[model samples]
Target: MNGQVNARAGASGKAGEKVLIADDEPNIVVSLEFMMKREGFHVLVARDGLGALEAIRREHPRLVLLDATMPGMTGFDVCEAVRSDVDTRDTRIVMLTAKGRETDKARGVGAGADAYVTKPFSTRDLVQTVKEMMARDAAE
Candidate 1:
């Protein structure tokens, strides 16, 4: 399985931790998937908003890296839905999108995102943010 993803040998995915990558962009998904796996996370991928919401319901991921826009449900809509649901209210959300305006950030936060990362963001920083957010939540 050349180029296949595998958790670093003997280093299983972090216990009780799963991350859902919800994005419509293929490149973004590919990179985020690899990065999250390397960070000891069991990764789940969703290509659109509906799939994202479905994955959230079924997988109950600890965190969701969500795109701001997609077909079917939009990230904002999904965020609101998750925030409204008691069972998923505590799930951390990081909005990932090209919309970097103050209003956009505000909208993301208003919808209940814990963090909003605009597109063209440094992947290194994104990874660190994810680690920090997830680790902090786990500790709490």
Candidate 2:
């Protein structure tokens, strides 16, 4: 219908959401950052739990994709820490890990994570989960 169609009309769509990707694996970080950016989310990377915490403080992202295992602080530890902090307590957290065991998922939820996605996952799944969390947050 036009050379350059700009049909989008929403404030949320214009600002774009910010998502922090915390993972010890460099490849995972790079891949997730690329995919999130392509999806129009501002992406921040943290290589460890400490780094994750720092990034959270600095970025104040709308959502966090946290890893279950890391050098200093595990995902559970990170989630717990974030939940305890008054400033970041409201931030949405999603555990991303290779640990697919039921116990691990339970642990993540117990630590204040909103969702859990196992490794070797499709980018579509990850993006969908993040969007769902954002939507749920908006409703709350």
Top-lDDT candidate index: 1
Give lDDT per model, in order: 0.84, 0.80
Candidate 1 backbone overlaps, count? 0
For residues 1-140, what per-residue lDDT tens digits would candidate 1 score against the true structure? 11122223114686567888888888998888888888788887787787887778777889999999987788999999999988888899999999999999999999999999999888889999998997798689
Off by over 4 Å in 2: 1-16
Candidate 1 global lDDT: 0.84
Could you tell me the lDDT of residue 19 within candidate 1?
85
| TM-scores, one per candidate | 0.90, 0.85
